[model samples]
Target: GKTHLASALGYKACQEGIETRFWRVSDLVLELEKAWKENQLERFKKKFNRVQLIILDEMGYVPFNKNGSELLFQLISDWYETKSIIITSNLEFSSWNKVFIDPRLTSALVDRLIHHAHILTFTGESYRLKNALSKIE
Candidate 1:
């Protein structure tokens, strides 16, 4: 549901000619890993750096490995105060450590992310669940 809202915002940004990119957290991490292996990490980072808005969907849905965590932190750090990032997560601030598995990194990531961020929480049943129920009726 949150991903839907974030993607809608990304779509609107695209329509307005904003340089927006959308990526699922896991998929991004995989891409970054590949870039690192191919010795094009800097190029990959530069590509993301040029975007005005990035919508990172489904953070904390799966825990990241140490390498993935570091790459993600670097991405966040590089974009800090320069671009807008819309992150959709099912976990709260305190539980973020579980995903990163490193307290310090998690803290730093959270600090950079929430520094000038506006958080919007969605409550109630998920859209998928609502749709399934409606279909069954």
Candidate 2:
């Protein structure tokens, strides 16, 4: 369910007047990298820390180098139990080590997440083509 479930969750939280900002993982990393270069990383991290749910969409889709992997690990560890994180990935949990360069970090990350997480594996053909072909009829 990568179809904006986190955005919907965030929207609901916002309706209750809770602040939320949804961003893709790559976008977030890019923005934070930019912030780091501009010496405003604190501002971006603060925004993330304030969110009730930080949904990282499309994890394990793109492999991160060691540094990026370490940065991600730090973020997750920092937010461990302090804030909720929703991660969406097409890859199975067993193959998560493929994404993160370091095995230890991957193990730690998965361990922390699975302890308080609910895994929901989605099954079906791609909905994109299904919806598009239906419109042609």
lDDT of 1 by residue, 74-112 (tens): 988988889999999999989999999999999999998
Find the 10 residues in a row with the least total lDDT in model 2.
Answer: 19-28
Residue-level lDDT tens digits of model 2 in 1-137:
46467678877888997756666776666676677778886776787756777778888777877767777787788887887777888888889899887888999999999988888788897687788899999
What are the runs in model 2 whose C-alpha is more than 4 Å off?
Answer: 37-39, 132-137
What's each prediction's clash count?
0, 0
Candidate with best TM-score: 1
Give the RMSD in angstroms, all C-alphas superposed, for model 1: 1.5
The lDDT values for all models are 0.92, 0.78
